[model samples]
Target: MRLLCLDLEVEDKGGFFAYPSDFVELDCSHKPINQISTIVGSSNGLLCLTHRYRNDSQYQYLYVLWNPSIHKAIFLPVPDFRLNSNRHYALSHGFGYDPTTDDYKLVRVVYVDGTVPPQVEMYTLRSGGWGYLTASGPANVIADWTLSVFMNGVVHWLAQTPNGEGNIRNVIVVFDIGHEEFDEMPVPKSLEGMEHLNMEVAVFHGLLALVPCNGNEWELEGEESYSIWVMREYEVVESWTKRFDIDVGVGLRRVVGFTKNGEVLVIKGGKLLSYEPSSQEIFNPHIRSRTESFYFSTYVESLVLLNVEDGE
Candidate 1:
């Protein structure tokens, strides 16, 4: 897993380091924050970042399209949404590239305190603007901590929908970049009724992989395990298969994402560890951090957005 390491030490200037062998510092000196608040997603060597800051009474968010390889970036304009200080708001985003149109699109979903339907918008890099989409988002509740994963030109998220008894159940919400439409996919039957299960989405071997992180939050120490479910066929309910069940012994604070080579990246004892599914062996890369949590994604260096106009 290529890491984008952020230094959280107060004594030094906060910056990012692309890790493993080469300690190269990707420049963010052009922006005021000089640090990326959130990495939404990356595709074709282009990264989508969000920066949030408070302005007097309310928080303002700025979206950026950056290509570190060429050190070029474009800051997108703010959306047409009102931010009332009294009302609570949660924002979720997904970024991907559309090969059909040769465009990079960023999706934003705004949920207001779980009372109103989510407002969905799409921002295309070529057009350089945000447009409200007809799809208001899934007719279900998106899990608060679920991160969006882009695979096969569709963005996926874990959501909750009400069942017959007015009970909430877990489901998958997907949005196509080409069609610009939203659709629903089914989780494994074993996981459908398990609404309390801590689940996450990932891509494995060119297929959608759903990981159920057992005992991540609700289980006792030394009993945490991860079960991977891979959808062999796209959009097919029955193709879900149980791939691996890894028992990570102890001190597992959280399950990070997966590596490009199919190794699972996990956190144990404030250090980064990689677990190879085939060998079932745990290897520590010796990445230690003082920060309590980490934000990471699989990355590749590319020249995307290098030729685009830099709207600074």
Candidate 2:
């Protein structure tokens, strides 16, 4: 369980998927998505990276805690916060596991100055930590692609209003690692207006899902027809259910979560499809040849990543 992709070009027959015939690939060729800039969440199997650069001009921020199933990586430690400008941004990032202090946390949403009013941090890898929630972040939503969706133990995102400045309305930004609270979850009010629509925040079955992808109409061999919405009641936000309508001829390219038999794990073009909406079939969990990125996230292979200090 682990699917990641970004900006492409890391081909080389990488691996993941402990269940659909079990694949493994992780020899570490500078792999943290090769110095990623975004993948910020995934619990139980750890994976929360953020590596923005530009040093000579501020904007540093580095953090990683990967665990590609024992390829074990930990590289975290650079958060005394002091960016001031490079625009000082980052609107979402969360990694979970707080089973009442078994620790392993990482929540973020900084905005030194993207539009002001957004700073909330927490690191705590068993107390070799960093913390500053100071009463939880509230900067009128967040933009630049907010992400973070670790179910039950809490950690969810999808809120935008800051740089868009006005009434954006569509909240769901929780974070409750054993009472370190900061809640607001309720998004399926018959949802719509997906900014451009392709929404994500997944983890179905283990609850807390929402996989919107309405891209209907496209027959030119480019296949297009979508409807992936799910939220069969994680305490009901009207139970937003529509799970998989996929005419997906190709190009959803990213829905990387699901398949505990619920199957809907996608990543078109770069291969790795498994969408089986009750026989709408699209098999091939063999993870086709040297695949590339379309962005991914789905993990579960822990040893607590062996406790930090491996690749800083």
Candidate 3:
């Protein structure tokens, strides 16, 4: 329950540059910094980053907690779980702060060979170690590349679980940070069988929101609109409501999360676009990338990890 002061800004120059107020581009020319695997999640201004590198014949990954404002970082120790070279695995991560314990926690779920009940582990800042969770995870495989939203001390993921008829369906997997419990919530009834399309759980205007598009941008030949669904009340399945529809038209690649002012950040072709719901207009901040690759996360500047030492 660590309260975050949203929209606070700071000036600092480094590998990551904030653009149009939200997106940041990594400067790969920086050594060691280039190893950032993914910008997993953020809480209280501390970023959870995974660094992957090749050690001799094996690959190794280290989790880093960093506060760009203070230029301080702490590298977490390797988890007790060992990689099985014979099998392939996919990793999903969630980060948040538990105000009850006054600790920051990182949750990692490893799916070995696309199997269910994935191996789950957590790293607590105060404990300074990683511990394995014994609970049985959701039977569904959490969607790769889908976004996870942290709200009200819980992290929600969009996953597709198989139904009784062997057909895949979408479900919201919930993980409570303080209790370290796993649970499942049903998605809006309209999106039940549409798991094939791109969908994500996002926070809109202080409520848990869902954004689902009709088709992938590359596959759509015509215009398409995305539906914004928000839960009027937390944990109340019946409270889910379709707030509005955003018509992004053609070449809308992805919905890149939202801005503090409630504008929708999206990707179109090779540029970043912001759509304002009230005005029903789209504005380009003139941000472009040669590769058309963008990673979006709401960043805040603080001194959360300023006291942590390396390798602690």
Candidate 4:
């Protein structure tokens, strides 16, 4: 697995993250230079990043599709809507590769007035521009920090449905990039009727899963519990199963992703750790990162984009 982190300085420079046992300052010489950006998602060795700026107090946003393994990138042209008088900036984005078209695409939804439905847009790599999509969008709030998980040419995010005046029920919002369509799927039944729960979509064994945060169990004492519900069959709610219940001597806040050998990696109190369920041994991967300064996610290194350039 790989990770991305910011350089200690303000300049947008840092190295590729490789987890080591000892806690040491990671080196940055190997990473490509970048702007301070939030990672919207990553797939097929491609990373989607968005950087927001203010020029004379006017909002400016830039989107980039980068291949860290290739150390190359392509800057996306601004969507037409954002350039209009309305300035319909995107509130969330999803990225995926469409095998059917042999292309990469981005899906974003812009927030307008609360009463106004979100304006959806689709960005195709070959097209190099964003076009409006009329696909169904979230009915209620979508957590801003929920980075989408791309799998099987689909992007998924944790979303919600309004239950009452101010309450909501959790659900998963799916976007089929190849088809340019949107759909909603039921979350694990265990998560149903949960108003105070927080969750995120994660890729588990190449399938979609929900990482439900057991925040109440997280503390300095007692055995803490962590759970993930894996969808054995895509788009089938009945197939959702609790694949694992991790009991750790220490507390953990999140299960971001998994490692190559199936070790579950988690973050708690700002440190990255790995738990081998078979051995029940937790070890520090020491993925040196300064949380306050950088955005990060796990990835697998590849030379895909370079091959694309070579073919071109």
Candidate 5:
């Protein structure tokens, strides 16, 4: 697989910065100094990003380039909306590429108020327009948080159901582009946790996977303390299994992404480790970092399969 590295100068404030201003793209296949400014959020691959211009009310926008060979970045100029507000309330929420129509869709979940049902807005790459999605319950249910996973020409988000005052249960909400529908799926019971442990949903081995943070006790035991659950079968609730248990002592913080060969790529401390699931063997591909003061939390970035062949 090919790896491309881009040197980005991000704002010191927390969360992802909108595209054009906060991103830099590098072409790894060819030795060129040409770096394109990314048009989407740095967290996910599919979402396009928009930032409020300091001088003007208009929002500056950009999109991510999936092609490694094309070092040039495409800047899409679209109509502005009031949704381009603060960076914290604004998120590059959900994204996905549809093969049937050969179109890419970018969605942003805008949390207007700090409480109640959350407001969601969508932007399509094909149409170069922004619109709104009909929320199921009150706007306060989703909160001002972003939780999304893309699979099969659709993006899935985690929905929250408040029990009483501060108690809440998480559910899965899926957006299908082909049919243009939003559906809900029940979350597995084993994945429940406290509020601090932010859970993430992912697709591994063509099956749904949930990665939960250990919260208060996660770092207490160090790297060995964290565990990831993988669902072997999709749309089946009982197919869940504790696929991997990480040892924080060895520097395993969490599983970032899975390789095409079914191996898991893990991030431990500031290092990257590749683990073969079947053999349970871990390989430390020590990727040297150029940054002098590297913080574990600041290293958060998206990982994608670079060299995997199509239709594999």
Candidate 6:
């Protein structure tokens, strides 16, 4: 299996400020045919990527690439789409290859100039055309910028709803791919104070898992606080159970991905921690380096680890 980490630098005025780099390329048996941007592991051990390039205006394009074997990467151009200067914007969110359909899909949450409605554009790899997915919620629910998580052939994202007076409620929006329908998923009871924490969602072991960071409290005390909630069954909004709660004294972070053996790998401060849900045992790899981003695959492969120094 092969894994890769990408370091992205965003420029500011006099100097450059470093943000968290995007995680790309998961562990897989298939070797990439060429160096392609936005590589992601598709279901059934396939490597999917797009030839993405940035223009002077900062827009991006998606060109599909595949490596049937380890030696070469094949670039496939969709019929209707052109690689010209079309102001195409590329997003890593909500883009993955679905094994069931054997098609790559690209979903982006964007805003149009004349409309107040938030729009979701979907592009299928096989058809090479764009379709609009209907969305339901307040105008501001979809974040102007946020990542989209795909689970069970559906895409999920966090949105906001304006309550009475001036308050707002954070809700989960789900889009079903098969039916092309939109629905809402109830957040876990434990997600009460989600606005105050850094949270993310992923599918683990045929279940949905939520990870939340402890924020300034953990930063000041040098402690880590995180929890993992697993969905007991599919499509049952409230069927979630807390699997594990991690409290590593000051300097540890939660694992962002799973190991080939199904162990949940977390990082604390600068160390790696693994938790096996079946055994409820936590193991430390003791790697004394800070990791910026991580991705996992179903097999063991050399992981693309990243380390960054303070920018000047």
Best candidate (score: TM-score): 1
lDDT of 4: 0.65
lDDT for 271 (candidate 1): 78
Q: In model 1, which runs have C-alpha deviations exceeding 4 angstroms? A: 1-22, 32-36, 56-59, 162-165, 212-225, 250-254, 259-262, 289-300
Candidate 3 Cα lDDT to native: 0.69
Backbone clashes in each candidate structure, one number apiece?
Answer: 0, 0, 1, 0, 16, 14
lDDT of each: 0.70, 0.61, 0.69, 0.65, 0.47, 0.48
Better of 3 and 4 by lDDT: 3
Worst 10 residues of 3 by lDDT: 4-13
Q: Model 4 over residues 130-248: C-alpha lDDT tens digits?
A: 78886666665556555678888788888776434465677787788877887778987767657665567888877888874433544522221256688999888999988876655
**Best-matching candidate per lDDT:** 1
Please provide TM-scores, in order, for all candidate models, with all chains considered together: 0.83, 0.31, 0.82, 0.77, 0.63, 0.60
What's every prediction's RMSD, in angstroms? 3.8, 17.1, 4.9, 5.1, 9.2, 10.0
lDDT per residue (tens digit) for residues 1-312 in model 1: 355654323222334545434344444566433333556778876777777778778777888887766777788878877677887777778899999999999998888877536888899988878899985666767664567789989999877773444766778888899999888899888778664756667776678887644334445322112577889999888999988876567555555666666677766666767788888899876776532334555567787876777554
What shift in Å separates residue 155 of candidate 4 from its native position after superposition?
Answer: 0.8
- lDDT tens digits, residues 1-312, model 3? 222211111112223435454544333322233323555678878877676666655566778787766767677888988775677777777888999999999998888888888999999998889999877776778865665778899988888874354766878888999999999888878777663646678787778888753234444332112677899998888999988777666666556667777778776766667899888899987665411134456566677867765654
> For candidate 5, lDDT tens digit of each residue in 1-312?
222223222332111212112323333332111122222332234223333334255344343333323222233444244544443343335666666766666666554434444455565556656667664423224432334567766677655655465665566767686665666665667444334435556667667776643222245342212556666777677877877765435434445556556666555555555677567787865542212111111112333324322210
Local accuracy of candidate 2 as per-residue lDDT tens digits, 151-177: 778877766455565545666777787
Q: Using alpha carbons, what is the TM-score of model 6? A: 0.60
Displacement of the residue 235 alpha carbon in candidate 2, Å:
31
Candidate 6: lDDT of 77? 37
Judge candidate 5 against the unseen true structure and give its global Cα lDDT, from 0 to 1.
0.47
- TM-score-superior candidate, 1 or 3: 1
